[model samples]
Target: MKSPLAGLSKFDFFGVLLLRIGVGAVLAFHGYPILTGGGSVWTDVGKGAAIASLPPSFFEYAGLASGILQFIGGILLIIGMFTRGTALLLSIVVGFAIANLIAAGSFQLGFLAHLQMILALLGLVFIGPGRLSLDRKGI
Candidate 1:
């Protein structure tokens, strides 16, 4: 069968490039600080996880894992290397973040940012890296 996205054109590819870069930058911005911020950041993250009813160990390990995933995934996404895999992983992370925030009664405007990021990442997952990316051997 033909691919559903076979109709996507060069313009769509450009749009995908913009989306990938924007989402990648945002992920890096949020992740880099946590990764480099030392123990206190992990403590805070663990506390947030605790508030969301996760296990106590989640903060120490999962927090670090999350940061690493976001940091590395963001870089890969921006470079268009393994774009689908990166977007998919980041989408899962963002989805979990949204779920945790909502579960913790944080239904405020800030959570909207996570929701938007999830949507954008999901879009990238479906659209692929586009022609401007390294995935396509572009510059």
Candidate 2:
């Protein structure tokens, strides 16, 4: 005895699909430049905030990891495969970035971005990955 609204699974699938894709794509897009070493992406957060205390190696690895995760997570989110898991992981990474910024006394911009990321991650955690996801199909 499913409710009438329960039958509208397709809409739910695409809705969640778009959310995941959009978020992931943005993250990947933002991360790509820094990861490739074309230039520093953390000019505002890392350099502008705490260049004196931050090591070059730390910046290098952080850039690489952020780019890789966002790129991979974005693609997976678009395809609806491992949506929640990827979102969770990316969320954690975002958290780390925020933490870094805060530690560097760049709480102004970093705090805002961190809060936004937290919201996105929280949505994925509670939303169950939507109907269009691989997890859904497997179920």
Among these predicted structures, which one has the highest TM-score? Answer: 1
Model 2 misplaced stretches (Cα beyond 4 Å)? 1-10, 38-59
lDDT of 2 by residue, 1-139 (tens): 8898886875776777778777877777866765665435644333432355777766655556676787787677767778778888888878777767677688696589777976886687778578766778656
Backbone clashes for every candidate come to: 0, 0
TM-score of each model, in listed order: 0.81, 0.68
Best by lDDT: 1
Please give the lDDT score for candidate 1. 0.82
Residue pairs with colliding backbones in model 2 are none
Residue 54, model 2: Cα distance from true site in angstroms? 10
Residue pairs with backbone overlap in model 1: none
Expressed as tens digits, the lDDT of each residue in 52-105 for candidate 1 is 476666777767777888898998988899998889988987877887798879
